[model samples]
Target: MSYALTLEEMTPALRVLRLIAAECAHLPAPFVHLTPIEPERLELSLHDVDLTGDTFNVFELWREALGIDPDQVTFRVQGNGRTRVLRATGPYGGADVTLTAYADAPAAVTTTTGGAA
Candidate 1:
């Protein structure tokens, strides 16, 4: 599967995914992937995340990475799966970022932020 994400529209969650992926570059292929399900969501995954020497939760890191308010993003874990769905929104733009395992195929990650226009 593939996600339609532009660099200009990259969200904090997306940036976090990129940072994690780059940091874990020593891993094998398909270690990480980011996909835009709709205008509001993106998908990401890594085989493993080293929590060593980290003082912030995923949301905090994402917030700092994206330079957005924590309220602008919401995270949800789908069932008992390893995937994580991040719903992000702002005055500029919004997106969903999903992080899961390589074995699990990408899903239709979608989101909508703010009140209806």
Candidate 2:
């Protein structure tokens, strides 16, 4: 991924993000972010985070926390790996919830240059 959303742990618009944070307290620490300009799209992205277990497990945990049905999630391929996105609306108005879970980036491969034409 070329970009990442970063935000300090602060109260977001309407406490919508805090609400979700409180709701998911049972899960391991999760980073939550809301665009100041566009508060409607709330996201919980797990990229570099260390969950101490399977990363995709967050999908299951979130489903239970948000009361989302298992079959409703959308799965798609992203590069050599995969991504799971669950789009949800409402625990409050003006909030478009999105949860994206993916495994760690593959380690860098070293290359050696030798021959010249």
Candidate 3:
């Protein structure tokens, strides 16, 4: 996929996100909130994700993780019953990373609008 950050730069950040996802695996929430902190810094938080100082651009992370030219990554939260969560998803390779909360759930979610940086 076309990306501004090379695979080298994007790798560590993507791993950080994956690690966060792993840590949050047990969480019923299926999403991560990408909030811009400064010019390019963004904070990713799960349902109970504590907003910390650590931040990374959402688009850069996704491009590396998914390894595809994404049309766009969608960030959204779904609430059902007593469950509410933030998530991110995008097209990667041939399949799409779909993050949803329901009787049947998918992988993961977030929001970014633009071409590859």
Best by the lDDT measure: 2
Index of the highest-TM-score prediction: 2
Q: RMSD per prediction, one decimal?
A: 15.0, 9.2, 18.5
TM-score of model number 2: 0.57
lDDT tens readout by residue for model 3, 3-67: 45554454444554566466544433335432222212223433322233112233334334444
lDDT of 1 by residue, 64-105 (tens): 444556666555666566455554443212344443332222
Predict model 2's lDDT versus the native: 0.58
lDDT of 2 by residue, 26-54 (tens): 77655676665554567776553544746
Q: What's each prediction's TM-score?
A: 0.30, 0.57, 0.26
* Candidate 3 TM-score, true structure as reference: 0.26
Ordered by TM-score, highest first, the candidates read: 2, 1, 3
- Evaluated at residue 59, the lDDT of candidate 1 is 35
- In angstroms, the error of model 2 at 69 is 3.3
